[model samples]
Target: MNAKIVDQHVECYVRSLLPEHTGLLKVLEQFAKLHNVPIIHPEIAQYMSVLLEIAKPTRILEIGTAIGYSASVFASHMKRGHIDTIELNAIMAEKARETFEDLNKSVPEVSLSIHLGDAKDVIKTLEGPYDMIFIDAAKGHYQTFFETAYDLLSKNGIIVSDNVLYKGMVATDDYIVKRKITIVKRMRKYLEFITTHPNLETTVLTMGDGLAISYKKGILNE
Candidate 1:
């Protein structure tokens, strides 16, 4: 399965067809690279842009805001939407706030606010029914995130979980390292739960690291 997934060369070729980032986005991408922050790849961002273009969600709930790269991307593409992103690390949250301000200067149609705290705790306090819920935080807590997302998501809404495959380790135990066994195990469980849940319909895409896109079972054609 991993062999069938896009290779580095193919991924690069696909990315070449996408437009180049400019302004703050370019800077954020560079900062993420320098700081070793785990931001989505450009191709993944493009993939998400296409989804947002179609969904046109008015309100988005983001579980992770690692310097706000993905949140800013969500805002920039959503045209008119509000994003509430949670970040546990104070320093990263501050940087994300700064990134939001920078993004606002250009994409003024979108609004973003950073919720600083553990997402598991913070999610409970949020008033939701959000159009979209994006989970990209700690791999071990994805199932918990989905539980919160299930309650918060509106009818016909979508739930997108990133790093679901964890570099394909979740697909097979052969690639799982000692340090990542727990994360891999948890991710596998989360994938199984989401894919098999009667209330949800999920498709795990091989793009980027890996993305699991799910929606309520009855809403696909609606």
Candidate 2:
């Protein structure tokens, strides 16, 4: 009866109907549930997988690596890409390393890289020019992350940001969540700035929580 349960159910049914998951990804998804990792919704995972399959990017940089659920899902579909995923939580990072190692048994082709630290500090040290950048780290840090995202992104790279809607709080009046106002305001500001930024073309899709897909548009301009 709850909205969160409804969302979860819908995502489950959609994943059930999807036709293309290979063996490792299916098992990896199951593991996500058993451990209660709170990876992206299944519909969102499908979106992420489809995008990876289509883009066929050579390199991906993910700012969050929570238990490596999404990272494994992404790896299973990435035929020849390298992934550099970061996690600020040391325990999660260690567990993620184990997950990636376990996945290596069946899905051995992917180059899964791990970075454990605050992304802002780690991003600078990372060898970038990544074709895909997925931001799912701290919510309040989205804007700070976005600023560097543009710089590290390749000429025609893509950026996918998760949870921009903040459980539908951004649209409500200020009194709704007066206590945590700072994050809501910052999220709205980031969304607004990203939508209007000249170098990128972005659309906020409402599939799950909300996904902000931004594509660098310099090639289209030229």
On TM-score, the candidate that comes out on top is 1
lDDT (CA) per prediction:
0.89, 0.82
**C-alpha lDDT of candidate 1 relative to the true structure:** 0.89
For candidate 1, the per-residue lDDT at 62 reads: 96
Task: Compute the lDDT for candidate 2.
Answer: 0.82
Q: Cα deviation in Å at residue 163, candidate 1?
A: 0.4
Model 1: runs farther than 4 Å from truth? 1-5, 218-222
Q: lDDT tens digits, residues 1-222, model 1? A: 243246889888998899998888899999999999999878889999999999899999999999999998898887797999999999999999999888888889888989999999999999988999999999999999888768888887899999888887888776777888899888999999999987788999998878999987554432
lDDT of 1 at 182: 92
| C-alpha lDDT of residue 44 in model 1 | 83
The residue-level lDDT of candidate 1 at 50 comes to 92
Per-prediction TM-score: 0.94, 0.86
Model 1, residue 100: distance off in Å is 0.9
